[model samples]
Target: MKILVGIDTGVNTGFAVAVDEGKGGDLIQVISLTITQAMARVIELCELYSKSQVYLYIEDPRKRTWFTGGREKAQGVGSVKRDAQIWENWCKENKIKYTLVHPKDNCTKYKSDTFKKVTGWMGRTNEHARDAAMLVHRRSVRA
Candidate 1:
């Protein structure tokens, strides 16, 4: 069996794990972490799943359009970008094979209403965690 690890990189990082079952994937766990803790957590998971090949899928932070009236949003976006660069560098250094999953490619269900409809109004523990799970779910054979 192989494990698929999905990540949502943002202010509050999200990570989820799923391993392939004979029929599809088995959703396992989800957690939220700080930017500083993200890389270490992934490495920990990789070590834990040593018997299974691990593939990571991280959501590429889409370009956020900042209001022309305020620079705050721009600064926030800058921070997110820096964090992403750190993740990329860590992955390269560790030789971890990974994929970047774009927001659009997953589906148009990110919005609350759309997500509610698709998930039967299921409330998630954390939005970032939900995003990570959804990303992993997208690559599931049953998806």
Candidate 2:
């Protein structure tokens, strides 16, 4: 089994988990969670999927430049960057393999309908989840 976890870190972080079994198609789960909850969920998933080959991919907010944005936007960017760092440190501590993907590496903003059509996934999802899922879009193996 191969488990891929994608995270879009911020106040309302997006967390997505896709599990692939050689015999069957991928099973994907997407949810919007608080930053703290995202961390806890990641840890829990690591424990539950201990036997699987798990990889984490986080959207790196540091890659973008925030210029002249309002205070709120600036704060949000700072918080997201901070959360990404936390994720990186946790992965390093646990010896988990992880990758930091640039925000613009792919099309992160996808409407729900478009996301469903693209991934061939009928599950419900929010913008954050869509962004996170797009990070591992290549690995999604649908039936």
Candidate 3:
């Protein structure tokens, strides 16, 4: 079994957990929560699946050079980048393997219907969760 986790770190963080059992069996779970809550969930899941091959992927906000949005957007971007850094540090400290993925690499932004169609995830989800889910969706697709 392979456990794949994807995170969109920001003020409203997103967490997606995908479990892949060989032979074309898989499960996906996604949710939007506060940054702290999301991190706790990630840690819990990692611990629970300690024996399995777990891979964590977080959106790297540090790749952005500039932002056009005003103060609010800039503040949000700053928060995201900071959170991403913290997540990276946490992964290193815990010796958990992880990957910092660029936002452009996963195509996070998707409409509700399109997201459901693309990922075959029917659960209710917010923008952040959708983005996070998309990060791991690629892994499931490949599997």
Among these predictions, the greatest lDDT belongs to: 3
lDDT string for model 1 (1-143, tens) is 66787787878887777777545445677678886676777778779876236777777655444335458867766766776677777778888867776666655336666655654435554777767777776355322
- Alpha-carbon local distance difference test for all models: 0.68, 0.79, 0.81
C-alpha TM-score for every candidate: 0.75, 0.85, 0.88
RMSD of candidate 2 to the true fold? Answer: 3.5
Return the clash pairs for model 2, or none.
Answer: none
Regions of candidate 3 where Cα sits further than 4 Å from its true position: 22-27, 140-143
Q: Which pairs, if any, clash in model 1? A: none
The lowest-lDDT stretch of 10 consecutive residues in candidate 1 is 61-70
- Model 3 lDDT per residue over 33-75, tens place: 8888877877787778882367788999898676788998888
Poorest stretch of ten by lDDT in candidate 3: 19-28
Pick by TM-score: 1 or 3, better one: 3
Q: Model 1 lDDT vs. the true structure?
A: 0.68
Candidate 1: list runs displaced more than 4 Å.
Answer: 62-70, 108-124, 138-143
TM-score-better candidate, 2 vs 3: 3
